[model samples]
Target: MPRQFPKLNFSEVDENVRLLAEKVFAKVLREEDSKDALSLFTVPEDCPIGQKEAKERELQKELAEQQSVETAKRKKSFKMIRSQSLSLQIPTQEWKAPSVNPVLSPATPVLPSAFLPVQVPYDVPEFQRVSISGDYCAGVTVDDYEQAAKSLVKALLIREKYSRLAYHRFPRTTSQYLCSMRDEKWKVEDEVYPDFHSPPEENEDPYNLDDAPDNLDYVIKIKGGIPFVYDNKEMMELNEPRSLPYPDLETYTLDLSHVLALIADGPTKTYCHRRLNFLESKFSLHEMLNEMSEFKELKSNPHRDFYNVRKVDTHIHAAACMNQKHLLRFIKHTYQTEPHRIVAEKKGKKMTLKQVFESLHMDPYDLTVDSLDVHAGRQTFHRFDKFNSKYNPVGASELRDLYLKTENYIGGEYFARMVKEVACELEESKYQYTEPRLSIYGRSPDEWQNLAKWFIKHKVYSPNMRWIIQVPRIYDIFRSKNILPSFGKMLENIFVPLFEATINPKEHKELHLFLKYVTGFDSVDDESKHSGHMFSDKSLNPDLWTSEKNPPYSYYLYYMYVNIMLLNNLRRERGMCTFLFRPHCGEAGSITHLVSAFLTADNISHGLLLKKSPVLQYLYYLAQIPIAMSPLSNNSLFLEYSKNPLREFLHKGLHVSLSTDDPMQFHYTKEALMEEYAIAAQVWKLSTCDLCEIARNSVLQSGLSDKEKQKFLGVNYCKEGPEGNDIRKTNVAQIRMAFRYETLCNELSFLADAMKTEQISALSK
Candidate 1:
């Protein structure tokens, strides 16, 4: 007979059982019987005596055995959910058991392995994809969160739809739907190791600023300033710039060499196929593709001329870099640090850089912007938003339930710090500010309040820091709550209460009256605004809005206009300026939107859509509005001619500053800003002066206070008693000042070049 041990709470043992254990249990149940120390839950084998107890123990053993057999049976016949390879014939969808787990939220409890009977495979093509129709951006109410839930589910479903579609169309069209994979594998992307920055504490209160790490003093990359360069040989090699159609190293334009080296080993595992496809379009690859006819015989691996034929996107992370011949490896082995030097020497006969290129199956040609468009869909941006992903759908409701499960899973502090960390990285790179300033795009009031609380906490943690938190998706909250008519009321209700609850006047004197902190939406344009929920219905709301009558189809415009007015009113009443992003997409109310927003908003995000209207650019320049541009994000998503209009806008003198908009999605950081700056600089061949002006604009137009701005503008503030006058100087020395500014520019350029030389030398050493 199989022996079974029973666990017992000695204090609660049956009287008869207690009597039986009295002899030996005396040590466990002492005369001091104060606090029951018998929590170890052990039972004396010879103690308890009861037929009923023994029967119960036997019954439990039987039940456990039954479960074990059932689990074994289930495992023996598990069906495949994902196709490991992409082939001509499309795999059909199959039904599976519903997820018996509770809704997935940050707060949701983790389920035991036994509970998850179905071993759901990572995201693949056959799972029903989530799709939000054109109406998703229109509007919905919190009451309609279920409907909102469905739409959100759709958004989540399609998050990886591009991943699957990218591979479905084969090598020819695969690039269109492919996105960058964080890992080189076909499975779901794992979280990046050693997060860029530490996360925020769960309970947000009573924080100490001193506990935070000292922010390293940032110096511009110009001469006499500290050069911020990655010291790791691997980092330098992998990041050494190269492109498809491989441009000469001496060329000014960007190539994939650096980015690929940093992440990938060879041609097959770089960015999304779509990115490679975009690259192929940028360069005249006819000769190369034709020369590499042998590539057709090569299966799976990415030919430098083409891409991999997988339904899922793969990326080059620490894992992928472990294999293959990397051109950057020559640089790494010659320069890589002891940490990453563990990588084995090249497995086969090695070739030098030039020889490696000459040995490629094909010869590459020119790289130009002639037929390329940056506005095209970037299929690889899905790695950042994975909350709603739950595979193995049995039916529609279960899928909907799956989608609904991730509703509260929207990341808060982890995301918040990711932004902060990116800013920190930028601070070390080519950034001008001593402190990293960032602007966030948010949707709901709760998100706004939480951001506000986080900002205060961050301030309390590092008070001298400056952060511009803007909300572009504020309208969704109004629509979700069905308060379109009372949009102003909602802003007031959320912002004011949030301020009162989080802020301590006696403590944070710098932020005395914080109002109108967050601002914008998914794009409040005539066309897209009408996509989510109807903004009209004059009689639907009365006496709530200043304009009781909702004009036909202009809800997007009018709603933004009224909210701007109300937010401004709140600012005036409170007597302070708060961070606001007057974001308007497309040409709807284009001029009026710019004028009103510039007057009230401190800055504008992605306002480059006004490329069609030159007059707006003139007004934007005249108003001296700071336009925050996220180059990589826009480049990955929008068409070149329409995306940001780098040449025209900068030429017109809009106070332009480069920012990493949604860095995680774009894989950008402070240093990445330099990449975008490099792209703009190379494409337009922007002069060093232009780069200076752009850097100046970012510092001057930043959300720093006037006194702090003055402090920041002080030329030799970082040095001890160095000779330099105030930038605002106006005397006989003004002429000298002009020469100094010119000198400063020269110094900066020299320093940048020297930094590069110094870094390379340091590593080469």
Candidate 2:
């Protein structure tokens, strides 16, 4: 049975808790508009007065806690548990891969070891381990430690609830610990995973529309931005929708408030901050002791290496998938080959490719990479507005429309050709894969069908490329132009067609086929821009939000998440592919954006803002949520290359992968994903194991199917720890995998111990 989350009531929430959430939101909003934008990306520093005062308060509190006899007894008990946990050895499991033929006839000859299944050794080669003993809670009072542990656990539970509700992923290890805390048995069947469609076979048709499931008599209506499914028109009239679990807005806001308040809690902040520091230091010590052993292990592995390990560019835009040189050459080649061919229409006059460039007072033959002016530079740094303009070639929107858009007069032929060319390069690379985001603006209902036709007409299917529908958060622009009457209408335009297609695929064959290759949705836009409205239960529903002012970030995430959740449930019931919400978050603006994403996003891109809040960062680490970082893209628009926290986050055991956000604007080479890895390796002095580990992470974080992952990583790729890692396939050291697994288990053990103490205290009471 699927786990059901308890519905929350807004009125039941304490006023003080609500006030605290409001304060947190306001603080982050002010920070977003502050001149010290760099501070958001770096660790905040306290002034001398505040630092002294904080230290004095902490010291006084510690002294008082030490004098309490009950506190002393609790501290001693905690120390004992910590010491015992530290001394206990991690359980080892021997994984022997099953033979190709389990029952072989006596006449059959034995297969060679190479031909046998790949087996991962659970008994990792012995290496030095870091152990700390005595007074584990020395730095903080036992009471404070327990408080932080309980709060962190509560936050994790909240996230788990959301992940399960939306069919997003939760770490198996963390889920097990959480189950133990609740005294409930965790089962493999309880695990919920998003369903992604696998690619078609070589002999099969990629664009086949005949295999769509039979239509059902389902009615979908978008009311206040939430999709309601009814059995038929009579049920719709009766207001009795099907019993699919729809999220309650009040409950969501209440959950959001809990996380918001957690980030502001003083004790939790200190605990998480210290733990993060310890993690970083612990990694440093582990490296010093076992660096060579890890390298030796990797060296002995056969065939696999950093270059050959499968890596996916998890975050990139379709329009800029091609680099400046590629785009420039394509433009010139089109002009040289088809100067008289009609490519666009403007002012009711058909125009040739040559005429389009001539209108802009330019000739394609004279164009160079520099003159194309699509590449980002120093001027673009910290200036997203200027960086966006770089999308237009030679400072002409006409050229952008002619070559980049999918709805042009020529049915996006030129744009499709360019994207296919980029796809060809990725196919040739063989080891590289990319999930490029294509736009889905909610200005009209026909947008989905148009995009689908464009895809089929161009035969744009690529085995190496998966698609993500990126909905740009520009409702204000549309609303201002009267393109949309209200936010509810926009939501309907975006999601209704998808629901319609899911119900009646025979009528929407093109869209149903296009959606198979699309594995997820992305909420994208400039994060630096701020909206004055704060999202709350009292906030206007989407139907009432007719103002030109854009809804706040939280509002957008919530509505998007709810719609996707319902959509996934519907699709899952029909045995179809489900989409993950991988939004762009934490790149800029308020740190609260990360909070919203914690409950809503499956994984996020550009989590640079995680550096600002230790509590949120620790939560992200515990959940093992994947973050796709694009440093080169950041260097051009937001943070400097050296200041990026990808290295720090990676060292701290955060699940992170490298990606090229925009190859056209930020890259010089044809291989943009490789360029990202090469620079990181050079700058950070990363080891071969580190690069392979990152590559392995990219594959895991991608939308690739389970079958594909098994081929790339191993058959048992879903298992946790060293048992899951196939050193032969991944080229990652078993020693490193064991260390990571042990460290995480150690952290979870502390939380579990805290819960046990709470149970005992309640029993005593």
Candidate 3:
């Protein structure tokens, strides 16, 4: 420093070293000279340093100053952007997209404001001809539904005392309820109060205990499916809301498995523990029934109730809620039928109700409220749907995580392996060509590209296999993550290529199914609403290709309507039929969304909620667009086990088929449909014959050729008996044969007791 460090040779040092040397030299100049400038550094006319060297230093100093200014500017801009973005009043989740420049840094860029969907001119021409006609359901009539309803009612009313049970949870909202209207209980409270007694006041009371009403035996007739209470007092009808009468638009299945989710761990495990408490009420059926009825003052709400059944044809329950013995059987069955099995894996353990109930709380030493306090426990179930909101709605953040984690594997070797697995499954099922369905809501262009490649490779071995895919936009905003791909890029870079590869010049039939999907538009918040796809030039925010925001499918309702209607003229030009599978469509059934789908739907998935919209249901029924319902998915998401709308759809004479949506995620077996059928069978209490018809509908609704469909159905139909010859039905019948046989034996025993009781009456006469 004393010698001025030989003028600090920064030029000889590397870029990083020179930067350090520059800082050191500047500090020395400030500390040593203070006010005096280092005249040697400047390019003076007489100085030893040349203008060339001085100019280079000056240029470097200018560059450094520019960088410092930019750094300060960027910091201020970032803070301002965040402040402004967070302050905005958006109805959905709070969001911000920083306006970052890629040239400056490799950071995230501000997402463009949601782009408006491109609207077509009124004179746009159509490209594809869409059609759905000439199917087995074409013969179904309203009269057929009425007859089926009648037969179903007759079957339900086979028991005299309880007669029937049905479920209807009206006031359907985000937070739902079971509303015992869907159980065997609905008959007593809402329809016929056979043992109803007007409560006693202290003054008007005799003993309050004796104030209980006497048994009132009433045989109610169900006409048009529902029994009108008008005869009790025809005058009350005028003031009351038009009553929804009952042949009870209800479907019973044995499996609550689809509808009821088991909380494995975490704090939410408390909900599962509470759910298990329902089992303790298995002891005193009458006491339990009272508890089930006591609390709720249903003065204004007359739609839910519990029924007393002397007969047990349809009362058998696996949850001990109905036929008490079912709880123990269901528990044992679940264990015995481990893994792929839904039947007994070994001989029964024969654990009695008392033994199991004791094991629940394990208070064998406690005296008061001992394990099965049927009286107290039943009260807990009165609001059976208390936890409806507990674990239902999946957080957007969670789905975003899935997208992020899923992206790395989507276009890699894992993709190949998944496709190979599908190939193997097709081979196992003995199908020449099989279509495995996938949704494009949370996917990137690479994912679809990878799929196309693997599919092409697979087609070498399986020529007949068809690749069917669905693309839909269920969310309006793009989450700030590198998981999802945007709508525009997907179409331009993904779907267009996939489709181009699929369509052949001579025959445009390489793609077996093209499902344009739209979902999540029926949101409560307007900000979160994404009714259609937003058309954006994704080229701007190019930090990630796979994380583009969701875009619309060619299947948005309004877009679909215009396209399909326009396509009608193209039928003569190209003899091609187009199909679309729009699912998660129950609530968003506008004339455009639902009615429009009639033109192109292969089948609609999760049309369970379609029952609410009568017009939509009728339209789909008229169009013969089969409803592919996944009971387990519905259970995990919505609808109580007893409140499954599949039965209602079937009763409406809707073309319906059983399906397993996201079976692996829902933890269903490889034969996912069977588990669905199992749950549907349990909660809806369906018979083997009904299951066969449902199973058959799946094949009927398939997008197979006539010959293929015929061959498939032919192999399924039973030749030996009145029932269908399908192996699935055969298996169900065998498992259920025990239940039916047991029912028959119990009925005989009851009949024998009745005969013995009546013998004295005949003698007295």
Candidate 4:
């Protein structure tokens, strides 16, 4: 036989039975152990222990599974919430379920992938195309139809009952009958009942007495297959667009409360359309419509030919009253055509009106004397205000913000210099002082103090030496802040010695000693050109010095001349120099000499006009002429000198192409000197190449080196100088130089022929 199935032991037969026994036993034990235990549900004390234990274990397993499922679901929900929150905060993250092993329950519902609120599309034709009548209903359902029918019924009932009419008395019983019949069936039930439908056969027939209501002569058709009665034909016709329910006033006053209620409860656009329609019906809205149209046009891109538009009352009002372009154009047109109509000077008038009107081709007479008088009363001015009164007020905080924002846009050095210059200007204006002579031309003490303070406050680090020099003069009082010791020392050391050298040697003997000490020169000795003394012997041979006799002039003159030469040389040597040594200073000197010459030539012996030395007088004229071709023989001493003495005097601060030999040693009358110089140049009409070489040599001989001298020579001094002086000097110089070089020998040959015989008699004498 096959192995028999395991015999069922009745003592351990059912597992569920065993668990239930154990649960009963446990409950009984628990109730015995504690007073607050669930006594009502306790099992007997004799329940099987094995059975109770099995039941407790089974129940605990079920509870743990439930809690696990709940916790997992909660965690999933938290992850979804976190993902949603993170999406809002950082929009890049995609939302997803958090769990790797999500066990979906049968009861749990799935969510949609995305959510968005619903909205009605407004661009549909029906939405934009507003109609005046209820006959045209957009997107209305059956409910809308029922409501319109009810309103019509109500309006008819009110109309018929209020007025004494036989049809009205028949209406209540008839209406009830009709309602009952309608409730029963849509079609008429009574055999005697009239059909509730349109008069299909009659298209334009006159209304019948029965079809109309009491006292109403005409009826208007509505959208819901209903009709309204009006006392007057005009009222019915006027209500044709809107299908107004109660158009007959004498029969019964129309209750517009329903219309208002509909509007209050309707869509905003719907209400707006109806309101607009009402206004149009009540008033002449043409002007308002035009204004609206103009507003739209003005807000769009501007039209160049804005004046090409229709003009009427609305246009005139817009032109006169509005600030918009269309209005301005209209006003301008009106002013041009009917100037007298423009009451420009009225209290209500503004300058914009005046401006617009004046800009047009209007007749002035039309603008009326009254308008002119009005404008005169207001003190109208031609100049427009640079700043607008509305936007550019002084107290506006936006102005300060703008200034702060734009502060960086201004270059740092420029701002500092501007402030310093403004301070100087203020001081100068207050004192009314001229330049150079600080005592005579400088500011008063108080002004100086203020200026110094101002400069100190505004000063910043500067790379320029000229600005560096100005700082001390403007900010002396605030030395700690404004003056840098190193820069101040440089100025003091260089300028003091240089200045002392030029001091009156007779008055300041110590200055003379200081110059010698500073420059390491020997003591100076007295010498005179008349006594056959050369400047070389009298003073240690200085740089740029020649063995030629010293011209009869003051030592100060010689000193200044030397200093100028020194400055010029230093500028040539230094790569970068300030704009200080310019034609202004050089030309100023020339002007000084020329003015003196002019005064002396005119025999005006004013102390200021009379120049002490004939040498300076000659030099002044020489400054006006070419220095290299000077009759006084241009040899080793004058070689490379190209600067014209006449040009120098006429202009100023001209770079010497070895031209600044000695300002003091120059002596000769400008005219006589020019005459002699012209004789030589005319006699030696050299070739263009040779004359160019002479010019180049003169420029090269200037205090500037080859490169710098070339620059100064390249720039036409006569042209670069002041106005009224020769700016075309380059062309003239080129022409003169070329003529001299091209025909020097030829001109010399002709000179003998040109010479008069009278000169031979003088030679014989």
Top candidate (TM-score): 2
User: Compared with the true structure, what per-residue lDDT tens digits does model 3 show for residues 502-607?
Assistant: 2222221222112111110111111112223211221222223233343232124322222222222121123333333333454221212332233333345666
lDDT of each: 0.30, 0.86, 0.30, 0.24
What lDDT is reached at residue 216 by model 1?
A: 18
Angstrom error at residue 552, model 2? 0.7
Which ten-residue region of model 2 has the weakest summed lDDT?
Answer: 105-114
Scored by lDDT, the top model is 2
Superior candidate under lDDT, 2 versus 3: 2
**Model 2: per-residue Cα lDDT over 1-765, one tens digit each:** 654457887564545677899999888777667657555566654421237778789889999988887777777667666665554434423324434312111110111111122253354666777877667787777778888999999999999989998889999878878887787877777888888899999999999989999999699888888999999999999999987775688888888888999899988888888888889999999999999989988887778799888999999999999999999999988999999998887789998878887888988888899999999999997788899999999999988888999998888999999999999998998999999999999999999999999999999999999999999999999999999999999999999999999988888999999999999999999998988778989999999999999998889999999899888888998999999999999998888899999999999999998988889999999999999999999998899999999999999999999999999999999999999999999999999999999999999999998889999999888877777788888999987887888788878878877777864464334
What RMSD does each model have against the real structure? 34.9, 5.4, 36.9, 54.8
Residue-pair clashes per candidate = 41, 0, 38, 43
CA shift of 253, model 2, Å: 0.6
TM-score of model number 3: 0.35
Clashing pairs in 2: none
Poorest stretch of ten by lDDT in candidate 3 = 308-317
What TM-score does each of the candidates earn?
0.36, 0.95, 0.35, 0.17
* Candidates sorted on TM-score, descending: 2, 1, 3, 4
User: What tens-digit string does per-residue lDDT give for candidate 4 at 1-765?
Assistant: 111111222233233333443343344234334433112122232312226665576456545644564434433443343343323221121224424421111110101121111122111000011113222222222223223334333332332222111100121122332233233321222211111112123353222212311121232222211122343567666764322222221111012222212212222222223222332332233222332332232233233111211100100000011112222233235445544433323256533323533444343335432322211111211111211111111223222122211122221222344333433542333311111101100122232223223223444211110111111121122334433232223223323332222322333333222221111111011110111221211333222222233322222122222223333222222221211111101121111222212211111111111111222232222122222223222211211123224222212211121121111112222122223333434544422222223334332222222232223343322111111111122111222221122122111111211122233223324
Clashes (candidate 3): 38
